[model samples]
Target: MKRIFEELAFVNVFAPQSVEKTTDKTTAFVDTSGAGEVAFLVSTAALGAGKKVTVTVMGSDQSTGASAKAIGDAVEFSDSVGTDPQTIVVSYQVDPANPRYIGLKFQHDGDAAVLCGVAVAGRSLYLPAANGWTVAK
Candidate 1:
């Protein structure tokens, strides 16, 4: 078995006043042109009262266009009033031919913005005939 690691796509902290009130903050696009499996690592500094966060994988056939579609259901992590810091990690598999571009979406909901950090990575194994592997450089 071959193993590969992707580069860190994004690393930043998001706060209520910094981000949009009702919108999704997507990370830098990753070229998963030949990747068979992708993974996302999401972490948060701290969560305020009535705050929640959801992470999902988004894909597209074209680098930049309207053909992009969400890969699957979002993985949600919520915090109640006066909760501690939280973190979530998830992975997803994709159709190598369909999802050429891969990215992560960070969705936040609450009266106050909760500081959060998100990063994405991907890996792929060589096909039987190709005998080669690719990863984020």
Candidate 2:
């Protein structure tokens, strides 16, 4: 029998925290070697008054991020930003082909301070979905 937990894995891309205006925040590269389809969740707390969160994806061959490079275009969940007034959870899907490691680089620009976080959940195609789990049948 296939278990749901056995087919999915989650990683903290960026923990929830208050981001300062015009400051660039970056996350360490995460290994996605065996993942097939991955979803990145960007959560925010009350982004208002033209406050914006811009996120860009970077791909690397190593987790150290020394070989990091832009994988694709930047994706913003709700950057029109004043449009949303409450905590929102936005998600994006990615299928990395060449790189084994991926990281996020984002910036928040606005007049108000906002709490934002990011995470990734992925399904593996070349290896076990979960990092480490023991289940008996």
Best lDDT among the predictions, by candidate number: 2
How well is each residue in 1-137 modelled by candidate 2, as lDDT tens digits?
A: 77877778988878889988667777767787666666666776666655667777788887888868877787654446475644434333446565777777887676766787877778876655474556756
Per-residue lDDT tens digits of candidate 1, residues 21-117?
Answer: 4468876556765666666666655566667787777787665524567778887777775467667776767675457777777777755555555
* Residue 22 lDDT, candidate 2, scale 0-100: 66
Off by over 4 Å in 2: 1-6, 79-97, 126-137
- Give the lDDT of residue 87 in candidate 1: 70
For all predicted structures, in order, the TM-scores are 0.65, 0.71
Taking all chains together, the TM-score of candidate 1 against the true structure is 0.65
Question: How high a TM-score does candidate 2 get?
Answer: 0.71
The whole-model lDDT of each prediction reads: 0.62, 0.70
Clashing pairs in 1: 16-113
